[model samples]
Target: RSIHVDSPPSVPSLTTSYVHGTSSVSLLYQTVGQRLDSTVQRWPEREAVVCVQDGIRRTFSQFQQDVDKAAAGLLALGLRPGDRLGVWGPNMYEWILFQFATAKAGIILVSLNTAYQANEVEFALKKVQNATDVAFKSHSLTSLTQS
Candidate 1:
């Protein structure tokens, strides 16, 4: 047996059940690239990243420099702003750099699951490529594996 309510679905009332993200701290409206730049300026020499297994370490200044170069490299590869690039890999330092560089270059970086096969990657890339509404631009699908 089914019972029906007379009234249509009503919005949740803002009482004990409703909680919001709004807080006393004012929001900082800025992009990741912008925040990175500011942090680099404030503490260029401070340690920004460290990967013991990879034997990699970078200060804020170094990280910013590398990110800039990486972003430029992406543009040089013929990927214009809004073009989709896929990066598939296990956790590594390069992932961090790509995260910032993509934002700087304005290229949309698609995170491909490390478990995805080649066909899956191709399908995902094609979806983004089609959305771009342009003739086939260069597809940069780089994969990295942890040692």
Candidate 2:
């Protein structure tokens, strides 16, 4: 026996549709750091991040604290406002941590493609004049910085 299904009716496209987004509410322009801080302040105990693969989880307050520590470490390494920093790796807790850290430090983040080869990484680093590179596990920070 075979199951028969009827197709759903198609809806007509709206005549007012445009390439640009139209919203009734006004946009709120806020930096990532500001948003993070606000979120932590409003919901300190709320779960902010969870990495099941890594067996890691953190609340908004905990995430913010770690971000602050990472930002301070970057600052101690001589990173200043507008300095170029590169993050080259896959999606991980460390990647998320560095993302917020860079924003908090006011450093420009140059995301090096995870699929990039050695030459491509070198080219990207040169193009962006990246002063520091953050990697994970096999790609140590010392090795990346040296490169």
Top TM-score model: 2
**Ten-residue stretch with the least lDDT total in model 1:** 138-147
Residues 1-147, candidate 2: write the lDDT tens digits: 433334433564667634334445555598899999999999999999998776778899989888888888888888998999989878878888888989998999899889999999999999878888877765232332221
Which ranges of candidate 1 are over 4 A from the true structure? 1-24, 130-147
lDDT of 1 by residue, 77-113 (tens): 6788887777776667777777788898888778877
lDDT of 2 at 103: 96
What is candidate 1's TM-score against the reference? 0.69
lDDT at residue 132 of model 1 (Cα atoms): 30
**What TM-score do all the candidates reach, one by one?**
0.69, 0.75
Q: CA shift at 24, candidate 1, in angstroms?
A: 4.4
Estimate the TM-score for candidate 2.
0.75
